[model samples]
Target: MYLKCGLLEDAEKFFGEIPLGNVVSWIAMITGYGKHGLGKEAVNSFNKMQSENIKPDAVYLAVLTACSHSGLLEESQEILLRLCCDSMVKPQVEHFSCMVDVLGRSGWVQEAKNIIECMPIRPNAGI
Candidate 1:
């Protein structure tokens, strides 16, 4: 697709043409933006998705990855907090891994270690 091909502008234009875009469509856009290092744009798309009442499930990881790659430490933490509070979506190990990466990348190694220590789930090899 255009997004996978790195055609972000074309992807956006095509996405906009959908009459009733679903959560999957939004995820594609967010993931594409994240992969392309457009963290702000990814967050904006996430907010827009929420405004439309499309509850986030596992998509938090994508946003977190975006924030991590872009060095948006605060934003990543905020998203993790929101994920923790959302009863409908349980936080996965992958989510925690992304948080650790974000924190560590931002030079918060101690905080990252604390998160690893305090997390209910066991840390995987990726962490």
Candidate 2:
């Protein structure tokens, strides 16, 4: 509720009040921080989620977006790699798009192109 209205502090307080916050709730906070371009906060929330033993899925597109916007390219790449290698979650078109965008924004156009070329599946129009 507070996050939807851009009330981040209020949202945080509410979030902390949710005893044993579930994955959905944690994702909400992460998404909200990302939407606001609070990359560090979003990353911190992600770490907190992991500490709580909440497994993240491909829905971390929000986190990727936040990292890209905040210029956390390394973190974005690490997240993608972790998702691909350590978890059962598969990267979607949205994740690839976000990665390319981040790389391009950071002047790594060639790297972005490499990602497109190396994609396991056919690169979609979005990529």
Candidate 3:
């Protein structure tokens, strides 16, 4: 399978062939791109899903977390900001976790700490 073999291209190809991709399929494709260190590709997948009328769920957000791992500041920040403004997706710990992880890794530890401080749900210990 794509996951077992880490064949992102093949995975995406097959995904594109799917007639009715549900939320789960969308998440899988995005996660596949992310796992392959393709943050922009993951975001593109998210955009494609949206363009095709797929509503992103929390799992989609998780896939987008690859931006943090990949250190894609602008793209990640844009998505986070959009999510915050949309009102459909509330900010959750995992969301904050991705942001914090990105910020901290990018040498913006102070800003990351501030974000954690300002979060509605206080970050769990050991963050």
lDDT of each: 0.90, 0.85, 0.78
On lDDT, the leading prediction is: 1
Of the two candidates 2 and 3, the one with more favorable TM-score, higher being better, is 2
Q: Which stretches of candidate 1 lie over 4 Å from their true place?
A: none
TM-score of each: 0.96, 0.93, 0.90
Q: 1-127, model 2: which lDDT tens digit per residue? A: 7988999999999999998888789888988898888999998888778777787874478788889888889999988887778556777878888889999999999999999999776888878
Where is the poorest 10-residue window by lDDT in model 3?
Answer: 55-64
How would you encode candidate 3's per-residue C-alpha lDDT over 34-101 as one tens digit per residue? 77788888888777777987777665475548788678887788888777776667777788788888
**TM-score computed on alpha carbons, candidate 1:** 0.96
User: Which scores better on TM-score, 1 or 2?
Assistant: 1
List pairs with backbone clashes in candidate 3: none
lDDT of 1 by residue, 1-127 (tens): 8989999999999999999978789889999998899999999998888898888886788888888888888888899999999999999998888889989988999999999999989999888
**Candidates ranked by lDDT, best first?**
1, 2, 3
